[model samples]
Target: MPQPVLSLDALRALDAIARKGSFAAAAEALYKVPSALSYTIAKLEQDLGVQLFDRSRQRAQLTSAGLLLLEQGRELLQASQRLEEQVRQLDSGWEQRLRIVVDTIMPWAPLWQLSADFTALERFTRLQFSEQVMAGTWEALLRDRCDMALGLAGEGVNAQVELHLLGYAEFAFAVPPTHPLAQRVATTPDEPVRREELLAFTAVVVADSAAEMPGRDSGLFAAGHVLQVPTMQAKIAAQLAGIGVGFLPVHLIQQELLTQQLVVLTTEIPRAPVPLYLGWRKDVVTGQACRWWREHLLNLPWQQLLTPGELKAHV
Candidate 1:
């Protein structure tokens, strides 16, 4: 019996044809003549003893076998690229890629600014951003799927992971400008309702465990109607729809506040802001880009995010 030989070039040609949807398009992308591409596919079909594509239409459509082969081809190609990247990093003496996993609830402006600055240095650095729930983001770092994570500290984060306190993000109850809460006086209203009073009405909260405001454990949330939502955007939408009062980051709702779409609750509820931290594996030495970002985040003037009293408490 004779063993069959594998044809990598033919496989590449088939992969390109499947991706581009036509021999002409694949040829153009691969910088090969259409005849050459067709020949490669023909050879591939012969070697596999199966029809890879249906030729009835002007465009190429993958047969069942072709679809399976294309899926496997993509996985193989990705693995090959990862191997090549690792080898290239070894040769260069430093890995230039920075993989970051962050909580979806964090403010976007600072993060975007940091990313722009890092890439502007032109240091061969690549940035990968993974937006996940709080616990999910920490899991990514612990599993070695990401280099760092930004979110609240969580249980089960590995001992090897170092936590850097970035600052605190205060949580506030926001309502529409015409809501009754806005009509109340700012200085502790007479007969002030407890924090849980808002929950007597509909309370829209970030459904994800990671994005939830801290201090929820306080008795204020014990007996109230609660609606769980997945993202900040969804929570805002629900609030705008008058579904319920929502706990949201002040920065996220600044535009809404300015537009009079939302107003802060003046009830005597305890205000507990969440502490933000940047976590990374302590054993792993950070790259130049990651280190630069860590320093920048640490030095940010948090006073912008805190009120005078809150700033005094933090200091």
Candidate 2:
């Protein structure tokens, strides 16, 4: 006899039974009778010339061959679903991709969750993310490098660009436990440490991501040695290694602070929380994906969203 052609229905029946752990449960989930599911499974096994189930057990149990088929069948089913979703996405007028620029200081825990949710929608809109610092986020938008930006400085507000207030990020002055500043803070926490002492150590600063636009130097001092790193994570690592000392976002180093890996020092110049903004060009026509992001970000609670430790738990 010619080999029987397999169908999605048969594969689906097998997967459901394996996942649900019993024929009765699988039948209920598929909204079919127990006998119907059993028939499908039996037909599939016969077509493949294999005994799929060991019927001697009280509960439906798969044989070795049955488990192999079940594993492969689940993968096939997922691919089939993706194929259908891509078709639907083509039918809709969704954008092919979205480019988002996120500032280095922006907490990424919530953004990661947002990306996961977007993927679940199966809109087929590819998300491209790039990291920037300070002015670089704004420069990306102005250079037409990104569709949207988060944690941008408020300077040079464009009339054609829409801005959303994302609240302030508190910057804490931190150094490794072995750093000179950490050792010098013998007095009460309220008393200001000399600025000259702070200027003595090298400061770890993140390089701006801007290309054409003039980059910014936010925390650098004239007298101090400068260690310019490419990213915020690098700066964090550098500070932890006692390479330099600088202000870091409290949200990003909560764990370090709690573990005593980094010590907060009293400074004559206390860095205030920096206010960040979300921005996108208003003149350009936006696709559904862009609109979705704008709507979500505009309404997001900045304080809760930017708190890394709090958001990481839920993610």
Candidate 3:
């Protein structure tokens, strides 16, 4: 007998089934009937002469062999997709998809209007958005996970990417009015709280979004206990609940400051404003769609883009 040959269609069927959880669901995704997938996968199994999915489970759980095949198969599928996308860009100036990653500190509502404006152009490009915190923004760009990064922060950006400064943002050390820090500031309004005193209390900080690489700590000291939250919003919530104290973006907590839901505590040394940037990989071809997005984002006012709209409403 000859060795088994794998077809793209069969691989697609295998991928869809594994991802979608069941044959019926995969069929729906592939726009084919359940029977068709079952038949195709069955034929593949016959050709390979090995079990892929364990039949004993209710869901289409892959066997060890199937998982191995899938791991490689997904890479092939992704390459094929990239090839197709490149072809589309060559034929037309627009990319089929543009991935945009924004720092969590950046407010996304402004882009909602811009997205609607882009649709008016009738460009075939699709917009995808992701939010990253601190070093995670840089990591996403370095990992080739995103086409464009907005509000990216840190020291000098990587040489591989073109960087544009959006603006600088100031952070305020905020805590609930009932917290000791608040009382300290209120009693001695002129004096800034020392680092030792600040570190003695728990710090609420946003967890960095990077997965493979170790993420950097943004605001906390080595000696202090930390309350880690996934996003800036969560950190704000933690601070408002008086769980911990740390510097938060001033623009983000305007409403909280106004309503006294959270109050600013002066620190011994104020944090210097962080410079936010817009960046994209230097080597990757910048298609028209990507350029359009980059230009549009760069044109927006940084303060306006970062400010939470309902600062009138507190935590």
Candidate 4:
């Protein structure tokens, strides 16, 4: 890789000059002589062959090139400062970074609150969240793509991960009230919907986000056509639009059920509640930050809807 022509010192000097609005003032703020700051800028300009400042002006003002550098340079400065802080705080047993993968079926509003609560601890661990589907959630930990996973299915339990049963999410076969299936359920009221009759309709299913592993889907009962959506929201939207029919998380569609926009139909063969899991890599030693997250998140409503009742105490 080519060596950078501009150093951190050069960026700092440029930033200070721009912010302080004068070489003398910037030098004072930096605890250096005015000429020292001048020499640093001059050296940077010489190496890059760019006129960083307009000397023709009475007061020190940056040229167009200098303004662009300052724009990107400030971001670099903030990143460097954060890196320094993380390095300094590493002895506290907090990870420098924490990557979490959540299944798309889980509600995200609670997770956002969980992240905010983590930030309040000020551990200097950078938190990242990714939403995956089915096998994709499990593979994230297997591939070491993320530090921890929430809503992993119990199908592929391995030595690589330590998992906890988050809980079972009850699913219902919901379709828009205008749908033929809904009308059929309304007419019969007592008889369970036959699986063979469902074979003629389209089923909306959440597509597994697995990149390397084989993708798998759930709650599909031999629908003649399949419409795979990226997330639960899309699946819900598809069902609400009367375009397809499939099982959906009961908790997620409470409002639709209450409003009569969507109605749940009894099936001849009912889908068992799906088990969701919380998992992390077993190979690596966990840090305080990881443990902290594990504790807080387990208490939040991953097992239930994105409710505030449990999340408030943790937050």
Best by lDDT: 4
Would you estimate the TM-scores of all the predictions?
0.59, 0.69, 0.66, 0.76
Q: Give the range of the ten consecutive residues with the poorest summed lDDT in model 1.
A: 306-315
* lDDT (tens digit, per residue) of candidate 2 on 1-315: 986557889888888887788889999999999999988888888788899899897875789998898888889899999878877775686787899999888777778878888889868888999998877888889778899998887553679778877887777788877776676664444455677876787888888878778887656654478999988888899999999888888788988988888877766777777778888888877889998988877777887655544211100
Q: At residue 63, give the lDDT of candidate 3.
A: 92
Ranking by lDDT: 4, 3, 2, 1
**Which ranges of candidate 3 are over 4 A from the true structure?**
1-90, 303-315
The candidate that wins on TM-score is: 4
- Which of 1 and 4 is the better model by lDDT? 4
lDDT of 3 by residue, 58-144 (tens): 666799999988999889889888777668765888878889998988776778988999989866677899999888998899899
lDDT of 4 at 22: 96
TM-score of 1: 0.59
The root-mean-square deviation over C-alpha atoms between each candidate and the true structure, in angstroms, is: 8.7, 7.9, 10.8, 5.8
lDDT tens digits by residue: candidate 1, 1-315: 867644657667877887787789889989999999888888778877998889898766899998898888777777777777766764665456789887766766778877887768655567888776656666677678788887644443457788877666666667776555555434444545466566567777664443333323211243367777766677788888787775666666777777777766644664666666788898877666677777887777644643223211000
* Structural RMSD, model 2: 7.9
The reply for model 4, stretches above 4 Å from the true place, is 1-18, 21-24, 33-76, 89-96, 119-126, 155-157, 207-216, 222-230, 306-315
Evaluated at residue 278, the lDDT of candidate 1 is 81
Q: Model 4, range 1-315, lDDT digits (tens) per residue? A: 977898898899999999999999999999999999999999999999999899997997899999999999999999999888888789768888899998987777777788888888877888888889988988888999899998887664688788887777777788877788777777777777798988889989898888999988766678799998899889999999988989888777777877878877888877777788889988888899899889987886565463212110000
lDDT, candidates in the order shown: 0.68, 0.80, 0.82, 0.83
